[model samples]
Structures are given as structure tokens and as C-alpha cells.
Target chain A: MLAMRELSVGFAGGLALRRATLSVARGERLGVAGESGSGKTMLGLACLGMLPEVAVVTGSVRFDGGELVGAAERDLRRLRGQRIAMVFQEPLSALNPLRRVGELIAEPLRLHRGLSRAAALDRACALLSEVGLPDPASRLRQYPHEMSGGQRQRVTIALALACDPDLLIADEPTTALDVQVAAHILALLRALSESRRMALILISHDLRAIAAVTDRLAVLYGGDIIEEGPTADVLAAPRHPYTQGLIAARPTLSARRDRNAPLPTIPGTVPALAHLPPGCRFAGRCPVELPVCRSTRPAGNPACHRGGP
Target chain B: MLLSVEQVHRSYRMPRRRMFRAPPVIAAVQGLSLTVAQGEVLGIVGESGSGKSTLARLVMGFERPDQGRVLLNGQEAHRLPAAARRQTQMVFQDPSDSLDPRRSIGWSITEPLLAMGLRAAERHARAADLLARVGLAPADMHRYPHEFSGGQRQRIAIARAISPDPALLVADEPVAALDVSVQAQVLNLLLELNLTLGLAMLFISHDLAVVASIADRIAVMHHGRIIETGPTARIVSAPAHPYTQALFAAA
Candidate 1:
């Protein structure tokens, strides 16, 4: 199992993330959804021990009996490809431009497993096939620029799975992709997790994408985990007013919008880090907001008014 | 018609020539035609390279069509006088990059008005009113783009687009940047504006479910041509084109 406790971090005067506590069971997919500055990316990178020097992390992170928050740099480096793998947001930028596709995919296996060249090559091709890449062998020598966006993303997935790690954390994995290609890649990931029984952390802003993939969902706002519950329940009837507001505002289920309809708009923007509200972070924009909302933070509850067990 | 794109055919001149005999061409858009009635939304849906964006540019008058015509309110859109064409506006996909970071949100929102020679006091009041209409408070006019979240920044973009009360609004994948819930909010805003202003819209997106929401009529484009077009409910429930069916199936 992978879990976090009170994980908090921030960027130069901007609170990127805050008070985040989430977990993923061995065979489940946990989705982390939030906006640009909401700290979703910081939390993911912090887990990989890759946070920028400016980011100050304060919290405990546990994965499969090991701790990540305070682990030494050298030890964390060893743990990365062997125990956990991260598929970055941008495929082409994350990958080495000069390296051939095959070699790049096999890099983790070569480093962590100390496999021979032939063995690494064989494993790379298998991993490529697993990501649903066509002509895996024929594209071994292709450069990153030579491949399409979908292909490059597939190769990146192959690289992350080089070691078949227990935990896979993907941050905004398909942000740049269109729906069809994004869906195909998502299905590929699901298949991979089912086959390997690996824990998956899918971080994205798109609820539908996460809804189509995740087993449980956590809504991140103003750097805090406002709500966490089963995906369907949370989606169908969100408990937290903020979650409800998000639903009313999205176009995903707004198939009934006609000329006479009222467009649901969430009032106000998220408060900045330097200006994190004294009460609920979302109180400023909450339509059902009460006086207490501006004076005190609400406790995180699995049972909120909108959707709860 | 607020905007009209008729039989637009844009072909790129491929690089390299043996002897400059004739340049090879890559057809980006071929025989494409689209119209947006005032306050009516026409959704353009397709995958990358389907030429949906090219269609937007042609309608925006940023790119001249290689063939056919683009008329805005019964006149040439791009070729109209600067003051006349300013009646049209656009809201881009990514608000972060689309907005000018160096300037405050107030400046960016009122800049267009300033360029059009609106009095500073009037433009300021108009900007504030526009902000409130899009769900932001009038007070937020002083904040920079970096101060708001993705969803809120998008609101700012919407306000900027509608500040001039342009007859036509072209939004290219407006909600694509947002989270599912946030996307719902933005869509709701657009839908409301569509009702209130009766503003004609060209809503371009790759997500079928999104187009299924606010679009009055849906056009499915593949390669450079629109393979199918119909009302939202009919097109979604009973897509005629094989590609449209496949798209729905994949989604």
C-alpha cells in the first residue's frame, strides 16, 4: 500500500499544495485531480524525491513498508526505478532527445537490474508491446522527433515500466493528447496494472479521464484534499459543496444545456498561498457558504452532505 | 450570419523542390464550409490534424482561405475595416499562455477597449461588469493572471472575449484545459452567455461529450473535410458517419 499524511509543500510565496493525505491499495487506481497551481504536480514529484530545491516538503510518505519523505537522496534514487516508477507529464521533454527509442526504454532495466545489452533490448521490446505500440521492433532506432505524440508517449510508458515496479504514478500523463489517443493509452495502463497487480496513481485535471480509469477519487483544491471517496458516488452526487460546484460548472454532463438554461458558474477564484483563507479554502467561491466558512476550516470527512457512505 | 466560412481550401507549400517546377502541397483544409448564426453555437469536433483549428483561423480572419469565401455579418471577415472587424472576438484554449503575464488582468481585459479608443473610465467599468458576468468579482480586476486558478483564469479569458460585446465568439477547446468539474463550470458560463447575449459561437473541441453539451449543431471533421453535420442530440445518439460512430465508441 502507498499512503501519505499531511503532505504540505509550496513554491516561491505560492502554495502549490497543502495538507494532502491520500492512499492507494495494491491493485487500485487513486486519482488526484486539481488545477494548475493546486500542488498536484508537487505531490507527485515529491513522492519521486524529485521536488525542486525551492519546494519545502512537510509530511510523511509511506510505500510498501518504506518511507519516502525523509529518505536520503542516494537511497531514494535506488528506490525510484526498482520499487516505484513515474511517467512524467511531457514525454518528449522527459526522454533524452539523443537516445534511440529502444535504448531509452531499457534504461531503467539496465541500471536497476544490471541486465546485459541483449536482455535489456528484449525486455524493452516486451514493454513496448505492453504499451500497445505497433511495430515495436521496427521503431527501435527511431528518434523522439521521428515519432508521433502518441508513439512518444507510449515509449515513455515503456520506459517507466522497464522495471515493473509495484507503484506507478502518472502526473498529467495525457494532458497534451486528444481524447481517442488518450483513451487508448489509458486502457493500456489499465491492462498493465491488471496484469501486474500494481498500485496506480493517476494525476490529472480531467474528471472524465480519471472517472474512466480510477477506482477511488480525491478532489484537491487550494492544496488540500477537500473530499475523498468512491469515484462513482462522488461524481454522481458530490457531497462537499465545492465538489458539487465543480460538477455544476463542468460541461461533461451538461448535455441538457438549451437556450433557456442557466449556466452554472462558480464564483470567485482559489486563494493564493500567501493568502490561503483562514477558513475553508473554497469558501470565497462556495454558493452555500456560511459565516463559519470564512473563520474556520472544515474537517475532512468521508461523509459530506453531497455524497457520503 | 455572424461568421461564415465557405468552401475553404488551405494547402501548405511543402518544402524542397527539384527545379521549382511546382511546389508540393499538404492540404490542411479542403472544401470546408461553416456558419455561426447570431447566438447559435456550431461545434466543430475532430482529432488532431483534422483541420478544426485551421477552420477557426479561417473564420477568425487570421488566415486567408486559399479558396472559397469567409464573410462576417455579410461582409468579408478578415478584410473588413479594423474597427468593423473588432466586433468579432476569440477565447483561446490555454488561458495561462494566452494571457499576457506582464500585464495585470485589468490591463489585458481593457486593452482591446483602449485600442478601440474607449474612454479609460468607461472601459474600466465595462471590464469590471464583464468580470462579474463571467463569475469573477469586480474587485478581481486588479489581480494578475497568475493570481487565479485554471478555472478562474478561463473566466477572465471569457470576460475579455465578451467585453466588447462582439457579435460572434470563437472558442477553440475552451474547456479542454480544465478538470472535469471545473470544465462543467466553464461550460455553464458559456451556455449562459449564449442565452443572455444570444451570441453566436463556434465551439471547437476534440471531446465528443463536451460538443454534445452546448452545441446546437455538431460537425465532425476528418482530415480536411467535415464528414458529417447535424443537431447535437441526433448526431450524438445517431451519428451517421462511420468516423463519428467510431469516435463515440472510443470515447
Candidate 2:
């Protein structure tokens, strides 16, 4: 129900996202995986018309046959909470300290759905229960500071779900959480998407979390989508060198191997956006880069000169 | 043993919830004990509020244990003199926070050396040498912390930690802030340093897979206690404690 064709976001620093083409169907789960400065978050922000003031956007963003690019602020505002909702990494920052949990959730419902104060509060309590928060009635009266990190995250999820959005954009939603809590949140997101028929875009630096929750994966590097395919297929057999490097670099618990050996790591760090190579973004770091890779950009699904490694 | 903690106990005072009531004390660490052999890497895995950072502080002698003893090289760690305490150094989670933004990378790396009463020429030479050792250009030492990327800044932090030629390194989530590729590089650097310099390390992290990759021994911490401790392979292959098993399962 959503599509982006050659969408790019640039500022004074340079292009943060470049000619990105992507789509997400209703109830589809798409994972955007990248490190810092990789532009994964930018993709999500662009979809919601939430880019910074200085940001210069180009190309098309179509949602349900309507163009979102250059759309009126009034139009985008109406669609934001009602149709496309977001959950951030830090739940505490997303929640207001002065307000009670019930009010936080109900405000979105009242604003978007125009429900009565009493009715909206009732829906908020149900949303809390649906998102697996215990004792929804008591929790409604509690403030954000009184809740733990995981509980706060669940409340934020409840707030997002209060409007019954068609699309949910969770940007590293579990990165700030503990391992067990993170796992729980990932599972909750997956379950909510499936049950509500809500499309999901799970953006994270963690490949394991993405692999566990997402159906399709798009690997981003230096403002470009280096690889995009089925999550299972891409993980099992990564075609791009960057994808291969990322998978190899991760320390695995289930895998059996020598402990004394150093993990395989990609040499060098990601270059600054302005200093990025003219050709392929991955050219300078790719293990098997052809000469042409340094001068000419590779245009394909894997976005590599040496495909299917 | 390079380091030992003998039944260490620590608690903190929490504000009173009710008027006219005595403030309650929460146990941060309780009767916890462990030992690290020379050149060994002991990984402490725990979630937030599980007392991992508290343990690190106790080891670094930043906070004295309310009860029990922390020993480094058979001496009370907290009682060690200023010069002697330099033998144990720390690398914190965020390099950007640990590093001074205004100072040159060389200045930050050589601060410990300066405190040791080293001459200017000697400190400069050592800083340049240490930079190369951590896989950075020696010439880049003059640049400020902002000039370097996150991974490079971390390398600078490592270089600073090892500048005093410490016998034991306490790294608290050193690679947690780094990317996967960069995380692996830093982990390998720590292992390499441990091997080449015989630097015993207490590596603490919430990431099970990361600790598994580097630690010779793994200690699972829960509710201010060591629930499980064993060789890395055994801990990874078959954890005996239910908490440890749950932690691994979550990972």
C-alpha cells in the first residue's frame, strides 16, 4: 500500500538517502538494517513526512494511490497518527512525564478518531491490554517515570495502536531495552502486525532481531540500499559484500566454533557522507571489489559487481 | 590469580517513599566472589540493575565494598596507593563520553602517562607508539576526538587504557555502542592485546554472543549474585543455571 521511487533526502552535509526505491504491502513486514549514518531511519522519516526542516527531498512517495511527497502539512498530519504511526527507540523520550499513561494514549485516539473522552479512555485501556501490559486499569493511572523500561515501551506501543494505524514504523524500538525485554518487544511487534493486518517497517542495527521478526530485509550502507530480498534467503546466502561482512562480524550463540580465533571483521569504517566514493558506496571496503567498482556504480538487486558470493 | 573478589557486598541508600520512614537500602552486589588468572578474560553478563556496573566499580576501586575485599596481585585494591592503582585501568561503554572533545587525541591518550610523571618527550613518543599499536595513524594523534569516527575513537580509548601497561583491564560494554563490523574489530583488538601483553581483563556486557566470543570464563549475574560461572565453552554449550539458560535463550 506504500511505495517510494527514487526518493532521496539531502541537507548541507550531503545526501543522507540516495535514489532509494522501496515498497511495503498491507500487513507486510519489511526490515531496514544498517549501522549509524546508513540512512535506515531516514527512510522511515521520509515516509511519514518527518524529515528535518533543512532536509531537501526528491522523487516520489505514494501511499494507497496518493502522493505523500510535497503533500500539504494538514494532509500529512491527518494521515500520520491515524494511518501511519511510529514507535521510537527510547520510550521515555516518546512519553510525556507530566501526563498519565491513560491520557497519553487517549489523546491520539481523541485527535484522530474524534472519540469522546470517556470512550477514548476505554479504548486506551483495551490497547494497553492488547499490547500485553499487565493490569491495564492500574497502569492507566501510573505516570511514565513509575514504569520500567520494558513497561514504558509497551505503553508506547499501546499508544501507537490506540489509533489502529495501517502502517507502524518502529525505529530501533528495542535497541534501548535489555536482551529478554528486547526479544519480548520484537515478538509483540510481529504478533501485532499479523493480527491487525498492519504493515511494519522494523528499522534496527541488530541483524538478529531483524532476522527473527521481518519477512523481507533491506541492507543499507552509506545512504544506499545495498541488498534487498527475502530475509531468510538474504541471510542464508548474502549477495552483497557489506551484507556478508555484517553477518560474519556478528558473534553467534548457536554456532559452534573456536573461541580463541578472532571474529572475521570488515576492515576500515564507514566514510563520511560528503567524502563517500563517487562510484559504489561499498567499493572502498568490499573484499572482492573489481576495478570498475571504484569508478562505476553497480545497479542491481544486490548492488554489487561480484554478485551471489 | 591476577585479581580476586572475596565475598564482596555493596548496597545503596534509596529515598524514602513515605514521610517519617527510614530510607531503605537496596543491595547492589551481595556476597559475590570471583577470580581472574593472569592473562585471562572473565566475562560478566547481566541485564541492567543486575549489578554488573557496580561490580566493575568495585573492581576499579572507584567505590569501596561495604563488606568483603577486592584484591589485585594479592593486595587490597581499594587500599592501593595512587601509583599502584594505575596498574588497573578502565575502558567505558561510550568512547565519546570518556574522551574529551576539546583535547587532541594524543593528549587524551597520554593523560595517564602524564600522571605517572613522564617527561613531555616520552609521553608524546609513547602516545604515537600506542596509536600505531591500536591500528591508527600516528600522525592523526594531533586531531581532536571529533575528527575520528566512533570505531577510531574507541581505538584511541583502548590505546589510553593500555598506555600504563596495566596488568588488568576493566572494559565495561566497550563494544556495545559500536556497529557489528566495528564491534568485531574492537573485540579482536582486545583479544590480541590480551594474548600479546598478557593483560588480564574483566569484560562486562549484556550481549551474550559478544562475551562468548572473547571471554575465557563466563559469569552470569542475576539479582546481585553470580548465578553461574564456568568456562566459556561449557557455559555456551550447556548452562547449568536456569537464569543463565534463560539469558542464552533470549539471545
Which candidate leads the pack in TM-score? 2
Question: What's the residue-level lDDT of B96 in candidate 1?
Answer: 91
Superposed on all Cα atoms, the candidates' RMSDs to the truth, in angstroms, are: 3.1, 1.0
Query: Taking the tens digit of each residue's C-alpha lDDT, what string does model 2 give over A1-309?
Result: 999999999989888999999999999999999999899989999889888878999999998888998999999998898899999999999999999999999998888889999999899999999999989998889999999999999999998888889999999999999999999999999999999999999999999899889999999999999899999999999999899999999998877567567789999999898888877898778889899998987888899877655
Model 2 spans with C-alpha error above 4 angstroms: none
Going through the candidates in order, state the TM-score of chain A alone for each one: 0.94, 0.98
lDDT of each: 0.82, 0.93
- Candidate 2 has what TM-score? 0.99
How many pairs in model 1 have backbone atoms within 3 A of each other, for residues 3 or more apart or on separate chains, i.e. clashes? 13
Model 1, which residues run further than 4 Å from truth?
A10-19, A253-255, A288-292, A303-309, B17-24, B96-107, B113-153, B163-165, B179-182
- Per-residue lDDT tens digits of candidate 2, residues B163-231? 999999999999999988899999989998998899999999999999999999999999999999999
> DockQ of candidate 2?
0.81
Say which candidate scores most in DockQ.
Answer: 2
